[model samples]
Target: MKIAINGFGRIGRTILRQILTTARGSGIQVLCINDIAEPEMCAYLFQYDSTFGPFPGQVALETGALVVDGRRIPLHQQANVTALDLSGADVLLDCTGIARSTDLAERGLSAGATKVLISGPSPAAEATVVYGVNTKDIKGARIVSNASCTTNAVAALVQLVDQVAGIDSGHMTTIHCYTNSQPMVDAPRGDFARSRGGAQSMVPTTTSAMHLIDVVLPHLRGRISGAAVRVPTASVSAVDLVARLNTPLAEADLMVALRAAADRSPVLGWTDQPLVSSDLRARPESLVIAAPETRIVDSRQLRIFGWYDNEWGFSARMLDVAAKMAEAD
Candidate 1:
């Protein structure tokens, strides 16, 4: 059950740490990292340091790779996925978010991997998984995509509502954090032509999270819409939701239903008191189902709020999904 990692940035490093520390036994002997950055920088980032917080075990920096609990993982310096030697791994985790699923998945399959899972969304995935919602559908998927953080949270909300109160329709606004792709200061960048020079400012853009949520929660498929705004913050974000309910539910009943749903969904949690984005980020869970300060503008509509750690929490869930894929194979 050996595994290979394609990127070593924030999500990539977090995946590496999760795989090595978990007792689930991924048997990830060789970590073939394909990144443009220098190999030593990747090693430095993956190497565990107690200064940040507590680690499950010690991580040592060996000659040219990282060692954890006596397993020495060889880090290949190759930048091209096709050129790398992946003959030993059973699965490959594509954390690069490059959206080259067809090429990378074919490369891994050619290299003798049983399956490949992408941490971010990919158009070629057999199905997009949202853990508690559609993980059962991934029993034999060859290639899978764990939806984005915003998608995960929104999907959880939709599933809970659809199961309990019943949803007529909904919309989401994801206030996300800055990513590594964005410049620290205002400068010309890629994508939106008008967004070329405003990395430091709030950039209103569209998010496919709502569109992709249907891949997991088919009941709400095409029934919801979403938009995104990139804030200056680095890690935490919140999802503001507005929904048309099938039946009017009292605030107390809705809160109880949400908490019950959270208890069922390990990644989804509930918080009663008022909380900021930073407070929910510290919960150490993939998704938190905070009972929103709900209000009914009319007889059949309700609104909710949810928060998540765009990188750490959601990325951790990606690692969990990848691990499950390895175990099933």
Candidate 2:
């Protein structure tokens, strides 16, 4: 699968790193990159990422190209989608966060992409997929949205519990790390709370995951609702989910059932280690259940906590989805 990244921010850079390391020789390769920054800045940022440490391999800048591991991927500084040369790319991964319309997204196809997989939620997407949970529902859509990071984390767990224990209703609060969307210090942005500082406070906000989950898990349409709290952190996030199950059970029993399901799941992970969010900074799993933190109250009330490196996990899944789209194409 040939990939073209449209943004070179946290998500975009990490996607390239995953392709070079964990996804190496897996038939997925980055063919080109498009960003507003110059090629020199792109190479510098990719080489020394403060969150994930160094790139591990060499990253050098050439004329209009970024060299990684001795391979030069063509780099384009095109702010307009029509100017991007995705000549041989099978999938154009839109990490720009601005491709919110079908007209903007479809322009990639005209530029040469066989399919366009958006990194964030898009009203224009023919399908909003959560990869491991609802990849089977893709059905060969030409334009697909991978949905949000929180959506991917929560949806996987929700499906697992609903299938294993049966969920009557649930609520999720993603203790997510602040993203580029928020400001570093107080500023006059559109939203009131978001105007206050991203790293300066624990700002409460809404998440689109609640709505996207319904698209991925249709039966649980009205069964689940979600919100998010942006904490002061660079990477790694947690999901604090509470559910009322149809069948009541002990805490131990629920753990056993969920673990078994995660064992069979593609993106879900299981970790019993006593660790904090910093420990999971670079974890590739979509959601790793912190076993000991899970508890049951009144036999029916369930609380579960799962961790994820939001940037890395989402990037990994996007690549996986892009590959699936390529196969169907």
Candidate 3:
């Protein structure tokens, strides 16, 4: 199965790297990459050993191909979807984060792909998927979304809470990693006022992930409220989730349910020990189901913490889900 990626930034390159390491790599023939950045630099980024962490072996760049674990795989570069080489590709993962579903979806089809998946939620699209909660909804999904990392973490948490104790309501405060949007030196952006003043500040930002949470957890509509805090870190983020349960259980039982639920879903995990946001930074997987301290904010209110490697984790699951959907067809 051949695959094409729309952007070569964080998520796009991560997707490329993961596919190369998969058991299906040998059968996967071509990897088509499209980005506005210098294609050579982007290609080189995948060639060298990842600074985030080492994979099993080094990946070498060979002329117009990438040697993953010593196996040669052909590469093609394009600046945009219009020029992308997707002739034999069965799937396309759009990590551009442009959120333009119609354009990317059409481009994927035009490039000869049967399915198109995106790394982030597309508000205009039909399906927004959280790996554990709604992966089964991917049937006939020519266009699908991984939902943002915040969405994934929150969705999994809510699913677990609702299943074990039943949710009366839920809310989240995502202490997110800084993104390309903010200035490193407090320079002015087009929207000068909003991001202008806070180069080093803990910027309070509106999260689309909150809206996406409702999309993923349909039962939580009108019951959940959400917000975000964009921190100075480059990667990794945590969700501070609080939920009012229909029935209250002891803290130990709650942790037990979370661990059990995480075990049932590969995307979810529960670390028995203490973990911080920095601890999860650059982890290859998206959903790390670690529940920190549980607090009762009110009579029925409970607060929990979860961590994720926002870009890597979310992109990884997006690729996994898209591949599974393709194979199912």
What C-alpha lDDT do the candidate models reach, one value each? 0.72, 0.89, 0.72
User: Tens digit of lDDT per residue, candidate 3, span 1-329?
Assistant: 66777777878777766666754344555466666765467656766534365555776667776566766655556645766557677778777788565875567777777778877777545577887788888886777878888888788777877887888877789888777767766777765534544447787777777788778878778788888888877778888888888987777776677677778876776676788777876565556755556665544678877788887677667767776767855
Show model 1 residue runs off by greater than 4 Å.
20-32, 47-60, 68-71, 99-101, 190-199, 282-284, 297-299, 327-329
TM-score of model number 3: 0.88
* Candidate 1 lDDT by residue in tens digits, 1-329: 56788778877776666566654335555455566677667666666432224446666656666666677777665656767777777678777788455876566666666778788788878778987777787788878888887887788778877787888898889888777666666666666632433346787877879768877777677899888888877668888888999978777777677677778876787777788876754344666766656566665687777788777677677766776787774
Please give the ranking of all candidate structures by TM-score, highest first, separated by commas. Answer: 2, 3, 1
Each candidate structure's count of clashing pairs: 1, 0, 3
Residue ranges of candidate 3 with Cα displaced over 4 Å: 22-29, 47-63, 67-70, 99-101, 190-199, 297-299
lDDT of model 1, residue 272: 72
User: Which stretches in model 2 have alpha-carbon errors above 4 Å?
Assistant: none
Scored against the true structure, residue 94 in model 2 reaches a CA lDDT of: 92
Cα lDDT tens digits for candidate 2, 1-329: 88788999888998888888884327777888999987888899999998999899988888888999898888999888778777788889999888898888897898988899999999999899998898976777989999999999999999988888899999999998988889999988888988889998999999999989888898889989888999999889999999999999988888888899999999999889898999988787889999989999998999999999899889888888888898884
> RMSDs, each prediction?
3.1, 1.2, 2.8
Angstrom error of the Cα, residue 313, model 3: value is 1.0
Model 2 per-residue lDDT at 256: 88
Predict model 2's lDDT versus the native.
0.89
TM-score of every model?
0.87, 0.97, 0.88
